[model samples]
Target: MKFTGSIMITCVKATELIEKRQIQSLTLGERFKLRLHNSMCVACRAYQRQSKTIEKAISRWMHITNNTTHHLSQEKKDKIIEELKKL
Candidate 1:
């Protein structure tokens, strides 16, 4: 199937396009083809959903880590390291 300036993309191509969309903007033709594939393909749709869910989760985790100032005490860190060595 044609992907860039053409029509009809396969499931694999569609999923690749989905991932590319997350990192960069897709061309009009590429977006059209991906949407067409998603309309008819259940697995691709599910994959897209799962990808978005993971992206959101990672974004949230990063945001929380960046904004929070929770630091472990030196004693806590040493204790944890000692416990790990015991294993």
Candidate 2:
């Protein structure tokens, strides 16, 4: 679907909305913004798909970590924390 220029949502806003949906379900503005964006841009549609995949991977990783073990070597913890801080 083609959008009139007045209707196109910006990529940054679209990405924010997509991430919000991953964390929880979409808010009204997020839902509208994503729908508008996906309708207009193939790149945004691909971004939404990739975002969902990453969210799922994170959730699965967290679940596995919780089930397996909470303990880590101090060095491992420090390394992981450092990498996360970089992000």
Candidate 3:
């Protein structure tokens, strides 16, 4: 963080920060470094975009999968509904 003000984070570090950012909030210095790096590094900017797209896709897939995971047989559902009606 001491060197973050003027020094641009390396591509590797920038990419790491970008990934880290997807799951967690960054420190002020880390945010600064990432912004500095992305401002001047076109490749890192592209990488950030790609990383976000991938993360969103994975997140959406997980959400969809989770919702569908607790599958029930049609017979089981019908029994449950009939029991609920009795209640």
In terms of TM-score, the best-performing candidate is 1
Runs of candidate 1 with Cα error greater than 4 angstroms are 1-6, 60-87
Clash count for candidate 1 is: 0
Per-residue lDDT for 47-84 in model 3, tens only?
98898899889988877756546678899999999999
lDDT tens per residue, model 2, 1-87 = 333345557898788777777579965655766787789889888997888798789888877745656677999989999999999
lDDT of each: 0.89, 0.77, 0.86
| Cα distance off (Å), candidate 3, residue 51 | 0.7
Q: What TM-score would candidate 3 get against the native?
A: 0.58
Ranking by lDDT: 1, 3, 2
C-alpha RMSD in Å of predicted model 1 compared with the true structure = 8.0
TM-scores, all models, native as reference: 0.58, 0.50, 0.58
- Count of steric clashes across candidates, in order: 0, 0, 0
Number of the top lDDT candidate? 1
Clashing residue pairs in candidate 2 are none
Query: Which of the predicted structures, 2 or 3, would earn the higher lDDT when compared with the native?
Result: 3
